[model samples]
Target: MLMKAALMETLLEKFYKNHQILHKESFMLNQQNMKIFTQSWRPYSTLQLKGLVAMVRYNSESSWLFELTSVAIAKAGFLVCAIDLQGHGYSDGLAGHIPNIEPIVSDCIQFFDSIKVDHPKLPAFIYGESLGGAIAILVCLKQKREWNGLILNGLMWEISAKFKPTWPLEKLLPVAAFLAPIWKIVISKPLASKSYKEWKRKLVVKNPNRKAPGKPPMATALELLRVSEYVRRHCHELEVTMLMVHGEDDVVCVYRSARFVYESAASEDKILKFSKYVASVDW
Candidate 1:
């Protein structure tokens, strides 16, 4: 009995040692004086790393949800890193209030470039979900020939028409945005109900930090609309290899928008995959 107990203790010790070796750390990176919360999952087992995957998270969401995914990637001998965008997660700025995407995109470039410089020999890829996907595309576009590939899940290529603001509100958005950019306006329908599947709906509510406002600030809404259109127009100019996955039943972002990018992109290697479930399942 003593020998058996000793064996169990030894196994437990190895488990904890391996866990320690995974090396999970969080730090603040200063970008223009904004403390961007960044996290990295790295494997300390070998020198020849699989690759580095720089992640951009979904809209109104933080990098915390990506922790499990990052750990899995690290276990597979890869380095995974992600940053909380301005106004999301633990980062500075008003929550869920991005008036313009340019600054966010610039932050990505600066942080990602710094990571690349540290590990100059490792091949790097970009992975994004929802709004993060758009940011990833803009980043890759700005630094042409820098990244190896892109993996986007449930990308916000198109904002569904149903989610758009009501007639008068839509027409008056420009003026309202100018007048009261910080005012939060509720949409006719709740965004959470449409975003997650029936089973995963509870997970959304379970998150303590989840930003649950269905209505966006007028400025943010207008900026999102403009950004989607800009990405749609310029998607064809993308030269990097891309793999886009989307749920067919997604009521948030239109699936056709992803198809449009696949068809429009000048990339020699690009793929568009449609899934059976909803957006929540894709992640």
Candidate 2:
């Protein structure tokens, strides 16, 4: 399984010019969101890519990035599954509510199982962006057999935030987890040029179909903290043939982590690429 990643803008344009989409089955979302999903369901499966971003945001710009990436991989003749993580996109979970990375990665396994039920013994690969990249990494580590290669885009190892007396906030993060469930914070800025600040909006927030800004659920935040603790104490646990891309100015997640990931990866073939603008590279 060979994995590759591209920037939202360039990838979208290439996808638009050279791809096709066809609807497949509708992956059920959480109970509350089923109504919205049902209205325009039946999205692309491996054989099709027609109904890409509509599931998350009816006309979202970022839709095709995932759709195209999945399609390109499939077209090139590989078994691939594009996921909605836990609470985002058209998966079965609440928005911004993640109890832990384990469950989400578990869902990923179930998804692979669903695929295996149809095509047993087939291999698979993953392409993850932002936090999704971390989820992909966990899959490779925890479910080693499930993945072959990984393409990580803006993968996050650290959350950029200001916590005065960081220790106190770290201790209270749990209690605050429940009491302040609805409180959303802008923990960091995009790691790109000022020019890209406006452009990235299409992939994450400004795009009508994107569901990423959904507040990180307490459970999800807890998992993030756990990942942070692990990285702080044991980043050496990472072991995968991953291609990591980061914006030189990315602030949403620290650039230093990208360096750490590149330097600390256990795989000899791992490649790290940094850029001021978004791009897709061969690693």
Candidate 3:
């Protein structure tokens, strides 16, 4: 029995040793001196990389499943990297409290720019999902012509009407936010319930780093609305090569709003795809 156990352990070690990708996890201090969790994946061998992909996660998502996606991309010959946004994952901040989007955007730019510096010659792409998609757009806007392509999955150009707080609550959001920034407001349902397919919902919620499912903080909710409006205003200014994918059934982010932004962007090389049975968290 002892010999058999030793053999099994050796086999497992060899299997991991031969894995085709190199995965790394580290932390970096942002401008505010907060330690932000970051991760990267690249091909293990000396194969020439096709490009670099910088990823951003959704508002409530952490580095868990995002790391799987990165490894897949890395195996396909790209260097993939992602940062855990403040207040999410292993990063430092108040849990799920984002009073402003600009600083978050700045953090992404700072991290992604540093990664780009290491791969200056390779073509680079920025990819984001859900709220991350909105941040990816903001990143492209801030660094016009720097990225080779921008890819958005279930882009949250605007919050779905079905998910927003009811009329009176929506109208009173600003006042509530002013009085109690951390106050959680009751919305329709937890986004995870609506955004993920039946089978995938379990996988997403199993994330240990995930925040509890409930209403968003008053300030964060209000700021999301403002950010959506800001993005809509600047959609016409987007001129990067782009590919946008959104699910028609997505109730967390407005599908119509995503299509509107697709049509509104100035990118000559752009494609918009709609999937019928998919949801915002289908990824």
* Candidate with the greatest TM-score versus the true structure: 3
**What lDDT does candidate 1 reach at residue 74?**
73
Instruction: Please identify model 2 stretches exceeding 4 Å from their true place.
Output: 1-18, 21-23, 28-65, 72-79, 116-123, 161-171, 178-197, 200-214, 217-219, 231-235, 278-283
What would you estimate as the lDDT of candidate 1? Answer: 0.75
Query: Which window of ten consecutive residues has the lowest lDDT sum in model 2?
Result: 51-60
RMSD of each: 6.3, 8.9, 4.3
Taken over the whole model, the C-alpha lDDT of each candidate is 0.75, 0.51, 0.80
Error of 1 at 251 (Å): 2.5
Write candidate 3's Cα lDDT for 42-158 as tens digits. 887645999999998756544556666777788888988898888877889987788998888888888888899988998999998887888899989999999999999888767
Query: Candidate 3 — which pairs collide?
Result: none
Worst 10 residues of 3 by lDDT: 8-17
lDDT of 1 by residue, 51-126 (tens): 8899887454443345556667777888778888887778888766789988898888887787889888888999
Model 3 has how many clashing residue pairs? 0
Q: Per-residue alpha-carbon lDDT of model 2 for 1-283, expressed as tens digits?
A: 1222345545554553454333244464432333222211122344432212111111112244445455555454454454555555544456656655666566555555555566545444566666566656666677554555567776665665632125555577678777876465332243333323554545444443544333344445565778766655554555656677888766555677778877876775688888875332100
Question: Relative to the unseen true structure, what is the C-alpha lDDT of residue 13 in candidate 2, on a scale of 0 to 100?
Answer: 48
TM-score of each model, paired residue for residue? 0.86, 0.65, 0.89
